[model samples]
Target: MALSPPLRQHPSGALARRSLLVGTAAWCMGAIAGCTSGAKPPSPVGSSSFTGSRTTAVAASSSPGPELPTAVRWRPGPGEIQPAAKLAAVQLVEALGTWPNGQSGVRAAAGRAAALGIPSALAAQLAGQAGSLLPPADAAVIRVIDAQYGGILSDTASVLVVCDQPTLTGRTVRPGGTTVDVRLSRTSSGWGVTALHPAAPGPARPLDEAAREVFAQSRIELPPASAADIRSGAVHDSVLHAMLQLAGSYRLSVSVVRSGHPLDVFGTDRPSDHPLGRAFDVWRIDGHPVVDPATSRTLITEFMRAAAGAGSYNVGGPVQLTGGATANQFFSDDTHHDHVHIGFTA
Candidate 1:
């Protein structure tokens, strides 16, 4: 397919590639630290500002390559959508939510303050907000459930992040979370967050309706955190829409949904999409286990294809398929042997 006019005009490859490299390197460092003897495993880093997992490959030559067949073709609006800027927005929001009582811990979580070009005064103001909201005796964990680009104009961008905030005292409990609007500006260093606020309340999006319906059916059971998030509209609309569509055809046995779960991809430092509510897992389709030999291979194959058709860009299960809108969009992993994972992109 032809590139969007804006994507065609702007230089984005270099910055995107750089962002991916940095994100991967950071994951590696965290992983190595976790395995060291006597070293406490580090907390999983929040989603990288650059999300390499979600990408669209552009054809290099005029002849064009095989098109990624999809129900909807992903398009970029005018002006380059800088991955660095999106990443910075995520990082800044995370930093604001993760402040602990101590100055050192607060500084670590908000380390990107300088990179985000936040003035010292504004940074102090943010710290004050955090201090008032959280108890010093308890640690607060902020998980980004999904982030969507609200708008992008030249060097300025607006992003909306749906997140869950759980306080860890004797036990972890999530009261609820809200959608936050983060505004960022491009800088020599990269994207820097300049302003933050709550998104204005509005009517339900497609995903919100779907989530409510699925949960109401009570046929698909959800993990507690996922249930709470669904009730609070913390799950991303895209993910909820995909699930609702899938559920219409097959009875789904859900495994994970959002918070109150592990935050990283198993054995890797890369943040899992579950926390962002952009992903979900189904262990059974129509009462058949995906990994069971009794289950028909054709059944699993069709479901995977249908998932992609339902707007999921990433699908994983016991079986891997080829020839989709993108190569390797359908994958298989040992961790996914027992279920099917459907992931959406912002």
Candidate 2:
């Protein structure tokens, strides 16, 4: 029988020391100097300590020493294919997180350009004469997409990216012939951008690299829903995300149920919010609703009122509503009494 490919070893100094110990006492002793200090170390209260050499141990409460860099290995995870695509996604996310929030004018615009997956070199192109290029929301959107997508990408794909841009007025546009070349590669730290090229040729084929990157970053073991399910709308996606975020924060599970009714639709009454996919009904794992009817109504109202304090596309669940019920909530009536309607922007 053939031997299986070896799993990637954790980058550990201990492993290297162990490897050096084979067949030679001197090698063992030399490699394990921490054990040969000639000093008697303390043992557990009930145990004994003696001997020529002893291994030193870190105290339980001690902070771990610096970690070694992980080595690259190409064993695929559940949804992984080629590894390069995954790396591209990681690169984009890392770059986006570098933007500082709260600036204005040219700085803001430059941040937006960077968020749109613009090359670093071209980031300056988006700067406005006054200050920053992007507003807070745009900067935030970029950060969200990067973090969410980066967290989801696969670990094998390789990628490279460029984020430079020169400013023209307050907008930065990718120039036709001056496009930067981005490249990436899979690494132990996940995908890393390896190169950026300018005045280089572009790919002749469609770069599903974007999709591959997104998929790699967010790869999960579950089978994807059907196309129809995906097409249900961004509203569904937004609300579900809010539910997940809320559930995660509380370390709880979310159960969803549809409110059944016609013109009497419980809370807010817009067909799109329910049937067409603007709202969600979240419950606990035990099948109990997240809140009682009276509480839910009050909570929903409060949630919408608080939305102004949150990021865009942030309405959903019991505690994590983004604000503006009439805008975020399409329906409010008796049908939604049991389950809280987690609504999202239209």
Candidate 3:
């Protein structure tokens, strides 16, 4: 099958060979096109930014030689659709009614809370954990609808929830919350909740937390490299600094996990950076801070370029941002969609 424009090539060097593996032709791209959501969508090239994942390593000799550009095809996920405002409004009302504090706030707050659904649950959890002296969230406001997916059989919703707490301390508490995507299914009694597993709540650690997780995995201490040594100083402080900065810019959190067959995204071989304590991955977007569009690309592009530039060090990628031969072969290597692999050699 033909590919979209050829995958961009990293500059010339040992890293260049690594780039070939990053976007190889082995991807059953036709099979997973339907899985677009969050940051991994088939966006139009140019005038838009792209998000992606790591793939299995492809041997340099086995890559299929040049093929023509084929029309890009993306499959629809189960029951995914844009809900009408009325349906959205009704769903919001039903969601709000499902919560425990619906009766404590003004009708407006209740309405807002209902509209956000599971995100409300996350907010409530954060406030309780924070030990807010204020009356628990009486309601939630859909401050932003970060992401939503109408799945093939069930739909999922992702958003940021804002809530109000009435307190005697005369102070307000803000608990950033992320929703674990409620699955919507068609029921005889109309659309009802079929699944809400993997519910994300507040207390989702900050970028600093993600850094600590990465550092914790380190059994031996290597001389600490400044952010510049890691990515030419484009990123500084620690992995936490990179993650927090990335989260703030990307409007998401950087998840760091050492194990769990279900969540191992970088694949079977431990990524180079994971062990050396120089690499990390960005998996989910809940409770993660949002970055403005301008700064959004700052950290991401910097890393991509840095990785491409420091090709001698790590073994992972989507490979190539400009400068030609672009491919997305890394998806085939493992469960890497929605994340990037950054390995450190120091």
lDDT (Cα, 0-100) at 91 in candidate 2: 30
Q: Model 1 over residues 1-346: C-alpha lDDT tens digits?
A: 1000001011111121124113432332231221122322222212221223232211111222221111110111212235566556555555455433232244543343433345555555444333322334244434454444434556655554545554434333334344454555565656655555443223333445576687776456453345656766767888777777877787776645554333445334456676676787665678665645567788989988998899877788767788778875787754455457787776
How big is the positional error of residue 206 in model 3, measured in Å on the Cα after superposition? 11
What lDDT score belongs to each candidate, Candidate 1 first?
A: 0.49, 0.26, 0.27
Model 3, C-alpha of 58: deviation from truth (Å): 52
Tell me the TM-score of model 2: 0.23
Highest-scoring model, TM-score: 1
TM-score of each: 0.40, 0.23, 0.30
lDDT of candidate 2 at residue 172, scale 0 to 100: 28
What's the CA error at residue 180 for candidate 1, in Å? Answer: 27
RMSD of 3: 20.3
Native-to-model Cα distance after best TM-score fit, residue 138 in candidate 1, in Å: 25
Model 3 lDDT tens row, 88-163: 3223322332222233333433333323432444324322222211224532211112222211222222211111
Error of model 2, residue 192, in angstroms: 62
At residue 55, candidate 2 shows an lDDT of 25
User: Per-residue lDDT for 192 in model 1?
Assistant: 56
